[model samples]
Target: MEERRRYRRLPIKLELEINSLFKQNNDIIKLNNKTIEVIDISKNGIGIMCSDNFPVNYYFNAKIEFDEERYFYCVVKIIRSSKQGNKYCLGCEFVGLADFLADKVDEYEELLNKSQIY
Candidate 1:
């Protein structure tokens, strides 16, 4: 069998405020509604570990609380999910993120770079 290729990820962590909604039957339940730690972030999306599993293609709004001076929102699309021991790892694509949020991502990336020096 051929080995599957994995996506290359950046080695950086960022704090994000995420609220995910999952549709159940005819109702919508909030699968995760709190602040989550973003393990890695890319131009297209981000990777986070949450407590529950959300269906692929589910849409959710993410509020990234970068610092005391910055906070922004983004529309995320669930890409892949996997259970790692007890926690669930979720990969999502940023469908439509606000300009302010995109700026925050850039700032957060810079902060991550600075943190590595210490």
Candidate 2:
């Protein structure tokens, strides 16, 4: 398969908590407090492996905590999903990624890459 992503996906493990999943009417359909593992991330989207088969095209808010005070939050829409053994791998795109948030993700990716180089 060919690579279609605009941004490079930085391979890193980050814990994210699903705050809420919304419906078309903006009503919350699901509330998840469990932490999911973010397999990879980029400026446009993130890949996560979780236990639930989240509905494709569904919108939700996720909170990612890099460290003590560094937290990134965004509204993401599920673009693709596939089963991986006992888990489900989901590809989600940021609905409206802010410039500051994009910068934060970029910085984190650079730092993560730097640490892996040693």
Candidate 3:
């Protein structure tokens, strides 16, 4: 596939909860506060590996905490999904992220580049 992404993806492992997941018709799927690993993140979206498969175009709410008091919340739209061994890898795009959150993501990407964190 051609490289078409406008934003560069930063490889970072973070634990987050999929607070809510909804189907195309808005039916909620119960996940029981499952903790999922965020494999990578970018200004546009994030990649997560989970035990379940996510339908493309479906939406979900995710909460990633940097610390006990600070966290980032966003509604994500699943763009692509694939199976990796026993787990499913999902690629999602932010529905509409606030400027502050977007800035934070950009800053994180910069830091990753500076420190060569991958």
Among these predictions, the greatest TM-score belongs to 2
Report the lDDT tens digits of candidate 2 across residue range 1-118: 9998799987767877776677677667665586678988888988999998888878888776667666687888999999999999999998888889888877887677788841
Q: Order the numbered candidates by lDDT, best leading.
A: 2, 3, 1
Q: Which ten residues in a row have the lowest lDDT in candidate 1?
A: 3-12
TM-score of 1: 0.67
lDDT of 1: 0.68
- Angstrom error at residue 6, model 3: 1.0
Our tally of clashes for model 1 stands at: 0
State how far residue 40 of model 3 sits from its true place (Å).
Answer: 0.6
TM-score of each: 0.67, 0.85, 0.84
Residue-pair clashes per candidate: 0, 0, 0
Residue ranges of candidate 1 with Cα displaced over 4 Å: 1-27, 32-36, 98-100
Q: Supply the global lDDT for candidate 2.
A: 0.81
- What ranges in model 2 sit over 4 Å off? none
Which parts of model 3 have CA positions greater than 4 angstroms off? Answer: 66-70
Candidate 2: deviation at residue 111, Å? 0.9
